[model samples]
Every structure is written in structure tokens, then in C-alpha cells.
Target: MPTVPASRVPRRRTPAAAVVLSVAVFLGTVLSGCAYEYSADHWDDESTSAAPPPSTDAALPQDPHLNEPVTGEELDDWVDAVLPDAAGQVFQTGFGTLEADEERKETTAQLPKGTYALTLACRSTRRVSFSIENGEDELVDLSLRCGTSRVNVVQLAADASLSIKVDANAPANFAYRVSRI
Candidate 1:
């Protein structure tokens, strides 16, 4: 059979095939764009220039009985009742209380060589920052929102010790307690 020359052959165009190819290309482009947009919006981009917002649930819940601002007298009474023994007293000595207009306070405690769980409760009506430092290292650094509490576990060597620093910005006299787990 004689072959038709390229210039002499008719170019047949199928409309259905063209429609199907066009639809496929359109769908591919749209889906790709949508997927890229979704990932860009939801993915955690570390390179973002803006600072990441803090977590809303970062604050811990406080005990019902000790979730209010306390006067010095009330704080003393509460401490005596809640921590009634030598062991409690030993832990309580590490806590700091902030009266109205007080600038700042720091308390230190020497933990024996062992693993211990530490719990901090803040009964304040205003925002405050509580940080626990083990020697030169920071162990627990958290901004205690109003009426928030926190708990952490710390392991200490034979000579390790910790300091509790409280910075208050509220007018209400606040009482904070640190106890061993």
C-alpha cells in the first residue's frame, strides 16, 4: 500500500478527545492549586517572621479551696492547716508570698539527691510569672495566668539545688505554695 505524504494527509481532530483532555488538565491544575494552598495555610512554618502565639491551655488548674487571693493572715493559716508537719514545713519554706505593691521575691530550696515531683499553686487575681531554676539551668519557666497552677518533676544530684523566682504585677496580695509530690 502506498503511504500518504505528511503534507497530503488530512489532520483529523476529535472533539470528544479534546474535551476529555481539557477537562483532565483543568482538574489537575485546580486540584494542585487547592492542595498547595491548604498545606501552606495549615502547616507549621518555622521560618515565619511573626512570633508563634502561646498556647491557651498552657496554664494548669488550681485547687478549689485555694484559688483566691489571700491576706497574710489567711495565707499563714492556710499554710499551717495544709502543711501540718515537719515535712510540709520543709517544702513550704521554699515558697514565696507577694503582698500588694511588692516588687519581687525569690526563694531557694536544696533538694536531696533523688527524683522528686514539684507542684506550684498560685492563688492570685492577676497575671504573674513563676520560674524555677536549678542552679544555673532553668527547670520550669511559665507565666502563671490568673489562678493558674503547675506541676513538674525534677531529678536532683547529691549537690543540686533549685530557686523559685516570683515576679508579680498585680495589686492583690497573692500566695503561692510549692509542695513535693
Candidate 2:
């Protein structure tokens, strides 16, 4: 290589710090132009406002027979009235009257492997306790108030025996139905 004097060598004309400061200033100017401001007049315009749509649902009908006492055929009729859409093949249906002295009543049914809805209702009673079991395993236990009905969904993995026991606080009429859904 040919030898060159120290002052004769060429060097970069621009310093790195100057180039970085120039880039920062350019970005700040560009970003400031994108700022937005909202005014009261803009919000007053209906076209830019957000409002909820009106509801289309009507009020539910009242049941006049909810507080009445019923038994035997009338008990069954009440169940039908409450659960109007009992849609599905019914596996079991039971209706009976419980005496004030009776402690409880238990019923059993053989249900195939499937999903089933168990509906229970009672009238003329203070409260009633319902216990449902699949063989040795208790599936559902609930206390139902008089003049009301409750539906529980049970899923059976295999064909099994189901036992339902109802205990009432006062003499009342009760009805139950098990249907596959």
C-alpha cells in the first residue's frame, strides 16, 4: 500500500448525533398533525350519537291458579298448566295427594342413557323437599315452595335406576314427570 499523510485521509462529513436529532424532530412534527379534538356541537349531532334500540318483549301472563290447592287429576292438570311445553317422550308421570301425617313418598323409575328433564310441582303446602338419586349417588336435592314448579336437567351416562323422594311440610298435592330431552 502507498503511505498517506494523516491530514490527507478523507473522513465522514456528518456526525451520528446530528443525524439522530434530525430524525427525532421530523417524527415529532409528523405525529403532532394527527392529534384530534372533540367539540360539544359534534356530540349534539344525532348522526354521530349512540342510542340503544327499543325492546320488543311483552309482559308475561299471570297465573290465577298458582295459589290454589289441587290433588289427583287436578294435580296432574296443574302440572300440565305450568309446564305447557313438556316436549319429548315422557318416561314416567306421577300425581298423588300427601296426607298431613305422611312423612314422605318415594318413587323409582328405570331411565335409559340420555338427557332427561325432571319436573316437580306442589300445592297447598308450606314447603316440600325433593331428593333425586341415581342408584347410590345423589343427583339433586332441593326444597320447593308451594304453588310453584321446578325443572331439573339430569344426564345419565348409562341405563340406571332413579329414585325420587318428596317430603312435604303440610298436607299437599304433588306431581312429577320425567321426560327425555
Candidate 3:
């Protein structure tokens, strides 16, 4: 019998390694054929209503900590700066820190029949979720990425008791304002 040299033997890949390699190749092929688009500054495209036209007046100051998460006083200041000025009558405005343990905060405001803009901004370790409802009917529900701002326009055919809920997976600071447009 002749003994074969170790260098002449073919290496055998483990089942786990083969599965991983197959998954990588499959994902690469599938992803390469799909086009993914993202906008860091705009709200989600599936929002129920379109955002109002940008104000042509002097633009507000840009977010100073656009690329990083912020907490404490810095988050409060960021929220204040990013909130849009009341173009018409102001219905509600609030700013506060959402503690990590608390997870969520809810508030309600009575708004008269009119068109209004709901602006929300947050600085957090993770994306924060927002749900806005007029009485029992949900108006807007979306999760905003950290360090971004969103403005949603909502119409009230009749007077409504508007409720806004904010939820964060971790500690965060947030601000929201509802004002007639």
C-alpha cells in the first residue's frame, strides 16, 4: 500500500461553512438586483399625508449633532432648534426627556377644525416611534431614525381631541408641536 502525502489530500469544508458560503452568495446575488434608496433628512415616503411646502422665509438652524446621538440638555436644545416656528395658531407644543425605563409618553390636545402641521424631532440611541390620533382615528404612525426630524400635515374636519404618543427603545429627548397652517 502507498501512503499519500498530506499536501495531496483535498480539504473538506464543514457543513456550517458551506451553508454560510451559500447564504452569502445568495444574498449578494439577490441584493445586487434590487435597488434600495434612502433619505436621511426626509420622513418616510409612505406617510398618509404629504408634508407642507417648505417655508421660503429664513431657514432654521441646521442640527448641530446631525451624525451622532444626543442626550440630556443637548437633546433638549436640539429639539428646540429643530421645531418649526408657529406659522399660524399654535395648538400644542411640548419638549421633554424620555427616560430609558419609562419607554413612552402620551399627551393630548384639543384642536379646532383646521389644517395643522405636526412636527416631531428626537435625539436618541435608537429609532423612536410616534403615533398620532384624532380621538379614535389614527392620523399618523411612523418611526423616525435618531437625529432626524419629520413634519406631517393633518387635516381636522371637525374639532378633535388629538393624542400623540412617543416611544423609544432607549433614553431619548423629543419635542413636538401642532400648529394651524
Candidate 4:
């Protein structure tokens, strides 16, 4: 008997059967992973597991290095804590001079729409706070040195004037002078 070639044999192509088998295999695979119940009585039952609740312990504390407020005894305690027991701090006392360019008469102290220049010098053993108040005459006052060696230079508005007195006895270590330029 002669062996027949596959191309010559009667080919029975059942497209419907292949399609049905493929759909049935796919449905079986997909349904295996998922599930559905048909019993109406069991559908209402709730027997599934529940998730555990979250922990509610104490909260973490904040760091103490962030510039805590010091007052009264606390300030004294802090000064004492930081002060070294040894002597010789190399304390130097001197005067520093500053000048403002009179050409452009304006400053960034948020001065009003006007022409003005004011300067003050303070000589003291401690620092001085600067303050600026807005009004008819923008006031500038600086805590001066102990010797009261504070000088104030003022150039008022065009036709405007001010009575500025430079007190040289504020006793402050640092000299702070502000001028509108």
C-alpha cells in the first residue's frame, strides 16, 4: 500500500466545533478563578472574613532645639547654662560709622510718597531695636548707646521740616543709623 500525502486526504474542517470548543475552554478557565452561587437561601448569608482595625497608640514628640521662648527665670537659667565659667571673653568696644548717598534720596523702609532722609547713630553695650512708624512725619527711633552718643540726620519733604534731636547717651554697644535714600 502506498502512503498518501496529507494534502490529498479528505480534510473535514468543522469550524463550528472548533469555535464551540474554544469558547467552552475559555469559559471553564475564567470561571475557575471566579465563582457564583445559585442557591437563593445562601446568597443572604454573610460569613466572610473582616479586616483588622488600625493601632491607636501615643503620638511622637516634637524636638526641643527649635528656639523655645525664654522668660523671667527661664531666661536667667538659659544665660547661666550657656555662660562659660572661664574668664577672658575678648570683649572689644569700638565705634562703627556708616554713610548714606545723598544723591538719590530714598530708602526701602516703605516710606510714603515724599522726599525725606533721616539718620540716627547709637553707641551702647547692647543691641538696639529699630522702629519706623508711618504718619505726617515718618518717625524713626533707635535705642541708642549708654553714653547717649546717638545722632539723627533728617531731610524732610520739599518744603517739609522736622525737629530731629540726636541723643548721644543711649548706651547701646552697636550703632544703628537709618536714613531714607
Candidate that scores best on lDDT: 3
| Candidate 2 structure quality by residue, lDDT tens digits, 35-135 | 68887676675664656578656685647555556766766677777666678988887767777655565656677899999998877637767888988
What lDDT does candidate 4 reach at residue 100?
A: 23
TM-score of candidate 3 versus the correct structure, residues matched by position: 0.58
Per-prediction TM-score to the true structure, in the order listed = 0.47, 0.58, 0.58, 0.20
- Compose the digit string of candidate 4's lDDT tens values, residues 1-181: 9998777778796999999999999999998899665866445546454444686656855344322333456545543443323232212112232122111122233333443333333333333444444445657666543323343344444433333332222222222333344
lDDT of 1: 0.61
lDDT of 3 by residue, 23-109 (tens): 999999998899866676467677756687877756677655563556677766676688857778887887777766455656656
Give stretches of model 3 more than 4 Å off. Answer: 1-75
RMSD of 3: 13.3
Model 1 residue runs over 4 Å out of place are 1-68, 77-96, 99-103, 172-181
lDDT of 1 by residue, 1-181 (tens): 9998777778888999999999999999988877333556556676676577886774776565444566567867755544334333345444446766565656556555665555555556666676777778887887766544455677666656677666676543333444454
- RMSD for each of the candidates: 16.9, 16.6, 13.3, 26.8
Model 4 weakest 10-residue run by lDDT: 97-106
Better of 3 and 4 by TM-score: 3
- Candidate 1, run of 10 with poorest lDDT: 81-90
Question: Which has the better TM-score: candidate 2, or candidate 4?
Answer: 2
